[model samples]
Target: MSGPELRTERLVLRRWRDADRVPFAELNADPRVTEHFRSPLSRERSDALVDRIEAGFEEYGFGLWAVEVAGSGEFVGFTGLAVPSFEPPWGRSVEIGWRLAAHAWGHGYATEAATAALDHGFDVAGLPSVVSFTARTNVRSLAVMRRLGMTYDPADDFDHPVLPPGHRLRPHVVYRLTAADWRARRTG
Candidate 1:
């Protein structure tokens, strides 16, 4: 099932398309873009990820949306809500996330696209709260989480379960925003 589309001042967050696969793979392969993860994704792995993302939409009714620049319609990346497959201490929760091409960075695209995703998660999906996390060293994503008014507590930090104990990216920091908090931020 294709997910609902969202629009921002500078972006269009919509479902993935066949045209998006190549660029998505390229983005996934960029070391600069995948630096927060274990390693850049191979083409096959990237395609597989897209398959899973599409399947997530089918099963959950919400999944990562393919993002594009509004006017030019250039595919930049993806941002949306997802259900974390692994168990965390916080229990079941939806996550708002984004990934963009290197050329899309520093333009606030992640922040813009993520805001729309958060709105849908809270306003449309009726999720009580949403969380975002990243490798501790990912200052860029951490900043976006802060901009979205997500609160962070060091106590919430955890070593990523999918990563080996000694891996540099295993250490992760989490940020959370409740529907109440999100609504407050919007109307206050």
Candidate 2:
């Protein structure tokens, strides 16, 4: 499938451009934005990440597209689906995630962009299910998961492998939504 554009009421999910680098790097550098992450990536690292994200779109027909405000065209950040690389509480899983600039918080952008991504994942990509997870301490992200109609599975929550063994960030909660659940939510 060719890469497709996803539009929401206030955002546009599309391919990334070289022009998005600066804002994208800025978003990655913010402590608040990367609070649950390992660390703020340097500009060079951020550039490499963008390259990988773009490649995923090219190769897989979908990925974390660059998200921008519909009006001023400002780059907010990205939201979409990714294959979780490391082993965790849920084992191997398709994880949906989002990261937006600090200035873009509190406006439901994550929810908006994620809802679009989930739609594309299930309807367009034919995924059987999608899961989201984050460090249990990341209340904000957990709230976003709840807003997206995902439910927590305590049995699925596990220690994240990437962090130092036994670190606080290692404990994570898993939320899941299957295609049927998504369809029901969309129809209702």
Report every candidate's CA lDDT: 0.93, 0.89
How well does candidate 2 match the true structure in TM-score terms? 0.95
Instruction: Spell out the clash pairs found in candidate 1.
Output: none
Error of 2 at 66 (Å): 0.6
**Model 1 stretches with alpha carbons more than 4 Å out:** none
> Model 1, range 58-86, lDDT digits (tens) per residue?
98888999999999999999999998879
lDDT of 2 by residue, 1-188 (tens): 35889999999999888999999999999999999988999999999999888878877788998999998899999999887766655566678999999999999999999999999999999988889988888988999999989988688877777789867688878999999998999999
Best by TM-score: 1
lDDT (Cα) of model 1: 0.93
Q: For each predicted model, how many residue pairs clash, with residues at least 3 apart or on different chains? A: 0, 0
How many clashing residue pairs are found in candidate 1?
0
Q: Which candidate number would show the highest lDDT if scored against the true structure?
A: 1
